[model samples]
Target: MGHCIICGTSVDGVVCRSHQEDVAFRFTGNHPNQLTPGRFYEGTVDGFADFGVFVDIGDSVTGLLHRSELDRRLESLDWDEGDTVYVQVTGVQDNGNVDLSWSIRQSPREFRGEVIDSPEGDRLPDDEPTPTTETEPEPEPEPRTADESRNDEEPEASTNGGSASVEPQSTAGPIDSGPPERVTVDALEESVGERIRIEGRVVDVRQTGGPTIFEVRDETGAAECAAFKEAGVRAYPEVEAGDLIRLTGEVERRHGGIQVETESLKPLAEADAEAVVERLDDALEAEAHPGEVEPLAEDPALADLTDEIADAAGAIRRAVIESRPIVLRHTATADGYVAGAAIERAVLPLVREQHDREDAQYHYFDRQPLEGEDYDMAAATSDVTRMLDNRARHDEKLPLVVLVDTGSTAESRDGIELLDVYDVERLVVDADPGFETSDVADGVVPDDGSITTTVLAANVACGVGDVRGEIAHLPAVSYWEEAPERYAELAREAGYGADAVRELREAVALEAYYQAYEDKRELVADLLFAGDDEVRSLASHVSEQFRAKLDDELETVRPHVETREEGDVAVAVLDTDAFTHRFDFPPTALLLDALFRDLRAEHDRLVVVGLDEADLQIRSTEGIDVRELAERVAERVPEGGVLASGVRRGRLSFLIGEREAVREAASEIAADLAA
Candidate 1:
């Protein structure tokens, strides 16, 4: 018996069972079957494919080192044919096809020991020194029976298919070899019932009251591997989510799926861990060339925003690469949802490709629709608090918050400043025309537009160069009625028909109001990019329901509203909080949109003032400088403490805490308009 190299325990093999994955082996066998499933081998580059590189391991084993297996992109590989590299033989199929995985450690010194896997038994390489002992001497030959002599002479023949119980005296384990062969989480299907090695960043770690489960993910896939120290104990207290690690374990079919029983695990250094992420960033960056993108819109303003769009796209790509979470904050409106959905649509696929975990997209990115007109302090506080909690609990990196459709306005300045306190960089892709996003934004897309925020976000998605074509119809969906001729033409060119576009608009608007807070991802994706003609029917049904709800709510509110002429303005007054459902579909904004559309005439300046306990929200057909109006009101009623709260929604709140004061301010403003 030989001693294990890592623990120095006596064993019958080159490495003990406990440290099997810590060792690498070179296959000298003739057939693929003779090569161990979990062992690494030296190989030569045979060829390359779009999916992976073909590697010739030995005389009979040629395996595919899939692009998904590499820590880097296939395009970045600088290897040529006949060039030597190292890979792990993860599996050998029944048809004799071999599957290979990439190794993070390429040099021989990285491994604990190397052994030759011959047909008869494992042995030391010819270049390596044989194991020697000081205390326990080598065994001498002893008398044996004729049958025993024959069996000893032909151990390979005796064990080939026969019942000869000859345990080959392979010298005990070698020194701490490096980590075992790295396999993709997806490749475990072929390796069921076999011991294998895999390397990945720990996506999640949880305890089952029995064993600690680590959800590890390589580029290709993710799986849960369990480690048990004892009953009801935490196996690896130091192991946490987001740690890059290499593990050796047995792949077993558990719960009708493949899971691993981990034998050993090692955390990889951050410097070495950068390889996998750096490769993904390179691929994402290559896709962002200007030549790859065609046109956002015919408008010169949209054209000018291209550079800013590209910058934001690059930042997003880098965040995903570095495994930093991205928090998407958008206004809770149809325009905002459309914009947020477009970015979400673009980012999820890349997240799935770069990281192996199925849930990494959810973990790495967030699509939270902001309430009201501006990303106010309350919203920012909640977002910062939740993000900090996640960072503390999961050891997650500080998230990059992308403000969609809201942060551009001056109203969001205070909220933006609060996020900046954490040193969090914020990017703003706003469709608002009135206010500049300069002071608070790290990256800003500046342009004037009645164009829906989705179109702007879509342009940003395309700026990334990997934008999905399926989102081509989403911009059309963002428009409630008259889509600009240029945008409509572009949408038509992208295959969005008039009916589908309208249906998508109705459906998204309705969905946006219902769960006004949640992103409603799968539902939105299904409604927007159903990939079939029937999606039109699906969107139409939801849109009709949305419109019907709006119609009923509009009629109900009309009785409570009072309309009268006040100087140059046609003022409509309504007690919003008393008449409208506080938490229901058809938001006050949408209802007012319909009211403004119906009441406005070419010569008439129609203003609708909605009042709720000390809050006044005003919407007008003709443009009103609400900030200037608020200044006027603040000057007129200094005791009221009436200040502009949300510029995007024309919202202002009174500090005096009285409903009568809000009505007085609204009345005074309508009358002051005579000036």
Candidate 2:
């Protein structure tokens, strides 16, 4: 038997089957069926066709090089008839028609070895002559001892031409050829500068200008491993995200973060991979849950939702462990901003602890503010498009979408359905009684509007990680009126008094209105969680602007407000388009809320309705089904095309041309219902 050329292993041919693909072949047989698929062969361009080009594998065999198999456009080909080229034989049909594909390596020199394929057998090229019986036979050398033979047969160097330095030896010395003991990523800090082996699943793979970075996660934690081939080239291209791989590398620090310099990375066998997966699943199940914690305040609604809150928190923590990105969507309002920020404050630290990359927090968590109170189709489309792009470009996993202070009402059903189609994990935290529960969400914290969404989110935040103090004041800020006494005391202990919390709420509300679509993470954090001096200074400045804008709007609308008495109910009405800023800060919704609160204080029972050209907003202390009211109005004025939108916030929309008629009918209907 001959020895394999790449490795000194006994084989029937010059190269073993394992390394046969590493070398290219020159087909000498005439029939197409004699060609072997998946092996590269030297060929000549015969001619071009409308669909593809024809390549002659040998003098008698021709194959079609379909345009679909080309890396570039077929018209971009610069080949001339009879020019030598390299192509891979993809398949040979039963009819003996051969199919060829493009090969990046155009010359045989690019391959490790090249041999001729003949009907007799494979053999070396003409330059390397073989010994014949007709010629003189050389004298045989004396047999060497086993030890001497082993010493002489040195391991052949790899000729794959990849730039990765895949030496599996330890830094101190040559380790045993058997698999090394596996180390967890969390323990990598102690093993810096020491070679180690690790087994995990690849969470993400990113190609940089210098190295290919693989974010791998095991039971303990996740870390980045960089494999270098050449500048701007991919290394270990076969390794992909979600692959269960066994990696050998040296732990090192880069830019104050732990990184592994990959020596060798290969996917594990099925049995070994299953074992690793089982281990990871066990650890993840144990660590994904948080310790039992009570709600921040003593409210019946929040107290009743304790288990659901814990489930939401557990999902967020589990996402961090799996290296899945968390996308937070919230309404662009004071309560919404506070609720979203509370969750962000709790999750950022966990992200840092779970990932070794310095930028892991940014990569793993993102917050987005919604323009309207509902998570509508527009918002869902934007989110889906961006996440799909991230998955395609970076090999990132689909993100966990958490909707806060919104997405509870039926208005958000369409958006939630879109996310369900992709099988994305979803969690919703809203205090609106109008919440439409669905089996699609992984977790939901529903309330009867006795508490604000900020309170629910803060409680969930506590269950996620230990950042209770960081977000203690957020629940208080969410309440425009008196916050729960317990939450107020918690905020005081966190160094924020009632006035300070109000200032922060005002600042966030004003900022949230201006850039309604932007998260404004840094600015919001400064307003809520910065040092006392910074928070006081920034919150005071922004609060002053908020008060000025709000007071101006209240003053302008109060003069136009028309008050009328219908039985025991005091009905107040104002033309929003004429009396208030149609497209400015202190939005119509906020203005209506403030006006309704003020009117309620003056009158025993009050209903404030702000009428615009095509929209109407109502606010009342009594529980009213705004959607039912809209349906009644639509029946009375069939030509108005009235529709109930944003039922949780009490909003109605109608055709602009029929606004006057719808307005009159809505006022009469609302009066009768109140009476």
Worst 10 residues of 2 by lDDT: 155-164
Instruction: Give me candidate 2's TM-score against the actual structure.
Output: 0.72
State the displacement of the C-alpha of residue 642, model 2, in Å, after optimal TM-score superposition. 1.4
lDDT of 1 at 110: 63
Pairs that collide in candidate 2 are: none
Best-fitting candidate, measured by lDDT? 2
- Cα lDDT tens digits, model 2, 1-675, are 666555445667566554555567888998988887767789999999989999999789999999867756777788999999988887899999898877767876767678788877777788854422242355474464452254335432221222123532222222223244589988999998776788889988876434578888898878888776543357777767888887867687654577887766777767778888998998887898875667776777766677788888989999998889999999999999999999999999999887755567778999999978898899999989999999988778899999998877789989999998998888898878656745556555554677889988999999998987688778889999988898899889988889888898999999999868889989998898878685579999999999999999898889999998878888899999988888998888899988988888888877788898899988776766888889999998998889998886789999999888888788777877766
Q: Give a tens-digit lDDT track for model 1, residues 1-675.
A: 886554455778555554444456777777878877656688889999999999887766788988877766678787899987878777889998888877655767666677777787777788777665333443574454453354355332111111112332221221132334556777899998665778667766755323467777676656878775532356667766766666766677654566787655666555656765664335545543333345566666666666677678877776776567889999878788888888888888778876665467878889998767688899999989998998877667788889998888877888889989998878888888754658767654554556767877887787554664667767777887778777777678877778768878888888888767888988888877777677657888998898788888888888888887777767888888889886787777777777767766532677888887777878776566778778887776777887877777777888645557657666667545533
lDDT of each: 0.71, 0.80
TM-score for all predictions? 0.62, 0.72
